[model samples]
Structures are given as C-alpha cells and as structure tokens.
Target: MLKLKYYLSLIVWNLFVNTLGKSMFTPQSIRFLLYKMAGMRTASANIRSGCSFRGKNLVIEQGVFLNHNVFIDSWEKVLIQENTAIAFDVLICTSSHKIGGPFKRVGDSDRKPIVIGQGCWIGARATILPGVTIGDGCIIAAGSVVNKDCKAHTLYAGVPAKEIRPLENREVNANIK
Candidate 1:
C-alpha cells in the first residue's frame, strides 16, 4: 500500500541520516544543507542532531528552528509555522491509537495534523500530542505535555498543560543568565 511504502522510506531515510550524516557536520550550515536534501525547509534554521521527521508531509516553514534530540512523529502533516522555535528534546507527535479498535495496534491509530503557529516556542522536553493546535506566540514550558489547544500570547506549563499566564513582555531574553 501507499502508506506502507511511505513508512518504509521514512525508516530507511532516518537510518541513513543517523548513521552517516550525524558525524559529518561540524557547523550548522552543513546540517541545514542535509535537511534540505532530506525535504526540510531549513533556511535560517537549526535542526540539530538526533532529530527525527517520520512523515512525508512534515512542513517546517521559514525561520523554524528545532534543537537537539527533537522528535516529530508526524504520520500526517505536522506544520511548524514560520518563526517557531522548538527547543531541545521537544517531541511533537501527530499519531494516536484508535481506542475503539478491537485489538490495539501501533500504526493502526488515526492520524491528526499538528499545527504549531508562528513565533511559538516549545521548550525542552515538551510533548505536543496529536490534534493539538498551538496558537501563534504561545510558549510551552519545559517538560510539559500539551494535550489541548493553547491560545496565542499565553504561557502554558505542567503535564496535560494548563494555561499559566499570558505573555506580557513578548520578549524572551535568550541571553538571560
């Protein structure tokens, strides 16, 4: 089937990238070039080592940056809008089990589209689940598991993350010590 082939190709490509491309890049430019060849939009972006993109329809828009150990289980279309930043160890997954099925299966689950809006920041080790739409300018805290839609200009934290507060300053000091 078409889906089967797609999955197979993804596996093969991931293996090749992990095995060969992992050790060959010293600078971010080299990694960006490799990502371009592998069907990622990497202009002004840094998708770090150990990152995984499993779906053919994974769309990383302009200025999107994914840091180290990022894992995207995008069986369907996972769209990271322009200027979004996914920090280290972040996992955005777009697949989930069909609980109504007679027997449980891994890939037999229904797939959903994950949309991370522009200028959003997903912190380290955060997990964005299937069917979640993160609004523009939203900030997901580190180690959080987001299972619902997050509003724009809001800061969300905790497991099954709830809204913590609104982003008052629009300026996250990246250089804060």
Candidate 2:
C-alpha cells in the first residue's frame, strides 16, 4: 500500500506538476494543489512555476512567496517559515556528501536540512547550501552563495555570504512578501 501511494504521487506529479503546470501561465493555486498531491507539505504558499523539488520533504508555511525558477533539493527537511519571500532563481539545496575516498568527489560535505525563518527575504539567484538556518528578518543579497547560518535581522552578501550589516529597521522586510 505504501508503494502504491508513492506510485500514485509520482503519477500526479508527472502528469500535473511536471507538465503544463510548469508553465508560467499556470496559476499558483492549481500548481500548489498538484504539488500537495505529490506530497509537498505547504499549507498556504504562493509558489510560481518552474520551481523544482525532487523530494517531498519541503514544508512551506503561510504567506511564503516562492518566485520563479526556484530549485530545491528536498532530500532532507526544508522548513520555510511564514512571510518568507524567496526571490527568482533561488537554489535551496539540502544534500551534499561528506568527504570520502579519492575515487569519489561527490563525498565532500554532509547532507543536512535547510531552515528559512519568518519574514526573511532571499534575494534573486542566491544559492543556499545544505544545513543553512537563516534567521528571522534576515535578507540575503542577490547572487550570494549562503554556506552558513545567518544571524537574525542581518543582511548577508558575497560569495560565501558574509554578514554585511545588521538590519536595524526590521519593518523594512515586513512588506517583502
């Protein structure tokens, strides 16, 4: 029965989500429903088309807005809290192998969960690596590659995502979603 359920989910995703539902013309509500059938655990999110999650371990809370072409590797848990604005072309990955033998280069890091706190704004084209916990009200700059935990109410930028500054006026990001 469990196996059957998995197969059914695949059918739903492949037929609905992986089809015209991927079109930018397709409404987010319909796409969200289809993704639910495929086992994603989003309660109330506005997810645009072209967002890809290979695994079903994604948890998107209310008021979360995922922009276009967002790619998530949800092999582990990905908890995106309420009012988080994930901008276009963001890549949230949860998988990376630990450093292994010389023959395999895939084993260089550990696969871990990614947690994005509430009222956060992930800028366009940012690549969030595995095990990153972005704190509440944080803003990641565009084209930044986040490889570590981001402090609350902070602004992060650059290749490895250094903390640029503390966001003293938290009200600024409240309207991001």
Best by TM-score: 2
Give stretches of model 1 more than 4 Å off. Answer: 1-12, 22-26, 100-107, 169-177
Give the Cα lDDT of each candidate: 0.80, 0.87
Off by over 4 Å in 2: 1-8, 169-177
- lDDT leader: 2
Residue pairs in steric clash, candidate 1?
Answer: none
**Every model: Cα RMSD to truth:** 4.0, 3.2
- Candidate 1 per-residue lDDT over residues 16-91, each given as its tens digit: 4554345434356776666666665445556667676666667888888888778888788888989999898898
Q: What is the lDDT of candidate 1?
A: 0.80
Cα displacement (Å) at residue 41, model 2: 1.2
